[model samples]
Target: MLSFLEGHTSEVCACAWSPAGSILASGSGDSMARIWTIADVMSRSSLQNEHSSVVVLKHVKGKTNEKNKDVTTLDWNKFCSAPPASYPSGMGCASCGHVKFKAGSARHGVFRVEGRLLATGSYDGQARIWSTNGKLKSILNKHKGPIFSLKWSKKGDYILTGSVYKTAIVWDVKAEEWKQQFEFHSGPILDVDWRNNVSFATSSSDNMIYVCKFGESHPIKTFSGHQKVVLLFLFSFSSGKKGDMWVSAKHYFVWAKLTVSNGTPTGSLLASCSDDITAKIWSMKQDKYVHDLREHAKEIYTIRWSPTGPGTNNPNKQLLLASASFDTTVKLWDVDQGRLICSLNGHRGPVYSVAFGPNGEYLVSGSLDKSMHIWSLKECKIVKTYPGSGGIFEVCWNKEGNKIAASFADNTVCVLDFRM
Candidate 1:
């Protein structure tokens, strides 16, 4: 919907929703990555608001009413390189203004924990880091093929990059080099997830998932049961809930991202979407489905568990699940009972992404319909609509739920400043 934010020259490839505060990152084939934030950069509503995030970085140390600062510094070239000479003096960060970097065809982009930094992978067989002000910080040019996926370590100390070369790399963000390199997949690596600050898992087109760690040359564990490429895998952690962490891998079953309850002491509750047009809640310990939610008529694409939980953020509240599907619908489920508490339908095409606000009071969805919807979960109604220039590939709420970011098929990313 936000057209004023335009810089890419080709179709956007991937987008990352900041687990931190109000920040967003998008990668495009135009060989560029863009970072976005709201105009009120100093707003700290995200603190103590994103469930129980342990990696959130502190705000910039300066104190002179940083609110109303432009989301990003001006005069930084679209290439994320040094500003051109024709620009007026003092147009950009004096120090980073002279840094040299040329953004390649971006394949993926993600923001680090505090929203102060970003990492983007490109078709140029490289990855680049940028500061929150959109200044280029570092460039990693090591992979052999276009990097397709990336995952930052929980503490923001490491970054894992997956590529089409049947290989993956773990880069030390501070040391600025490959901490370790891994190669075991028979085909291209499609997805990756960090299970802890030091270990992670990778799903490959070869139909396998590998558990690897830093400084290790071989996989510590491997899973091989999928009949087709394992296209999706997600790692989730909740410090407020027994300090538990888990990873889910999606296979030919038409995988869906799974979310764990924030802080349930008994056991972790996971919700998964499937191509069978159903949402199921499973017990991590029992390894069995506990409840089944059937309402959608088409394959479900995404699912997210509310950050609030039974014993944590909102002890008195029910744990909720949000599921989006190809049927152009988003459904909210009551986890304990597996009941379809509410069905939200407003998109004209397949719903590709759905996310719960940090407060668990709102939900946002994006779709091939070229629009984004912000729904009030408590009201079961679409409260707001944002127009778009192309079909949306993804939509996500920042940690505080104060900003929503959507990636477009038209090679652009739009960040909406949400007020509710």
Candidate 2:
């Protein structure tokens, strides 16, 4: 369940999975993107000569094999596609390793389009598409600044990306082109989410969340309350006939449902982190504050709900909630009762991201201290701390709940196998 790949000399920033769930795609600050198979990286002791960069010039008539081998004289096609599957694999131009890991000031972030299609945003102001099998699909060169975040819709037919240049765009998967451009915040768009095709929300350094519908040039509603720049915004869904719920964080954290239907949130319940060091839940429909759950002594950086329904023992009890903070701890809470359930500690630095594992029996978290920790719900303690690539900024759990993808501030991404 614990393994480390030291392929990136700098920081590994982003990690993603393929449709088949066998391969992992990672982007690094070394200006290289790599494809690692789960069996290859985990089962084997080493991958010798696997991270080669030699460009192979295949010939049809006569030529030397660039793979340190000599071959019969053959004719070579001067123009062929699919660059050599190198150490780090990501989208970049054919001539220069634009997507390869580089030194200072390079753009880096990775997102999955479909289950297999992967996209990377670079400081080079381009978004590159690739297949999960380590093949470059296309390069998007329309953006003028670093692409900070990228996401695919539920159906995987479209793409949404946020930029440091203060804008977010939606792309058409079929045409491989920009479909819509949304401009609202004056500062860089830090994060964005597409809510089941019904609506989308964006966070910004300008301390705002802009909600917009598809094809609309302007935001339908704007949520402004944070005193500092909003760093992340996430939307969640339930089975009932209601819209999506949104969770947003900045200097504060807030959650709300956009609209309401039949006493349920037709929209979403919105929540936010407060400078007061408490997380507040709000009713978007009622425009009234629900409850201010104050527990953390420091600022709450992140919050997430359990994937499972409310506890079976107390179906009427409020749902379970998890929150991380600068206090160097993560805490679980009963949102309905507004009481602390358990305190999870041991992180040395600020805990940036926390997530419930696939089985809900465990939780995973990433910390600025350069580690990912897997905690046991049964024991309510740190079970293990998986070393990180750089300063872990985010940790993502795939749909299957087997792999954990961690993004670092150093621009590298790491994938941890949870099989153990």
Candidate 3:
């Protein structure tokens, strides 16, 4: 068993690792985010001492009372101290007002591109950037409402920010400002991610996924196949220049991509996860359904292909697809053969977040139970569970896949040293 790492007063919202996997960065609802080094966490006594003065955890009845408590104390030089634009991790109001500046609530979520930087969306209606070493980078204060989600492009050059204010903005990270990338739906943007280069996709409370492209002012392709609001999405890759990929979801629907070669839409494929407790694949080219997978009794929330293994080189790899659901289990499927390989069960609460480790031998999941479970893929059993301060919202492993960083709903961040 490993000793747990702790330091955050409120719900921990976001966490990321430095490129070299030396330092971990986290954002929380306590109105502050922090960066911790590997050495800081490895030595339990050292980590506790350095983080002791950073957070003052008090069980308050109201969520908005965080500012009234000692958790608002910023760690001067040791923590986020940069001004609003400089990307300090501390919770400080950066809004400008003629009467009074509302700092808004603390952060709710965070995401990172690589080692050097990461992005966070806060209830204060802002998105801020930070260095993995715990330095503040920049602050964006344009969203009229709280930012719900933040995603970085694969290139790390740009980021997409979704807000409850009913709009999504693409930011040019290099320019240190907002870019007029595209306007999202009138509803609050729930999730967003880039698709390769030419296009990006966004989901909203309206239960729609808008496919957007560069230069266009509006969504070029509006995909409206899901009955419920889409929560998560990912794009599969193809090495061939002319081939296409697909995307899946919480409700029923898979989106297939078709490229134009001679000014013609060549192919299409689609997949759907329905309330009927079934998942199906579609042929976009034929505009019809192709196959159905009725493996689980509940809704599917997560689906991802194995970047390595059979999904890449071996034709046999194409048969593997990992899916997690409200059923409290994770099912590994042979997509090509359309059958189950294994069903992983351990978590007591809804498995809200899941990710495959770099080695593919371990799988990590965060749950509403306020804990993160690390499982051995080969053993198909829980190896360890790290308790957190609040409802565990997300868990992200550093580059080396040894240390895990987690975000909580109470505005706090927890760093776990697996080796411990």
Most TM-score-accurate candidate: 2
What RMSD, rounded to one decimal, does every model reach?
13.0, 12.8, 10.9
TM value for model 2:
0.71
| Model 3: residue 358 alpha-carbon error in angstroms | 0.3
C-alpha lDDT of candidate 3 relative to the true structure: 0.55
lDDT of each model, Cα atoms only?
A: 0.59, 0.59, 0.55
Q: Order the candidates by TM-score, highest first — what do you get? A: 2, 3, 1
lDDT tens readout by residue for model 1, 336-406? 46678888988899988877777878888989998899998888999999877688877766666667777
Clash counts for the predictions, in order: 3, 53, 27
By summed lDDT, the worst window of 10 consecutive residues in model 3 runs over 71-80
TM-score of 1: 0.67
- Give the residue spans of candidate 3 off by over 4 A: 1-3, 40-114, 133-135, 184-186, 238-242, 251-294, 299-305, 309-320, 335-339, 384-390, 408-414
Candidate 2 per-residue lDDT, tens place, 37-100, comes to 5553443222232322221111112542233121111100111122334325455534222343
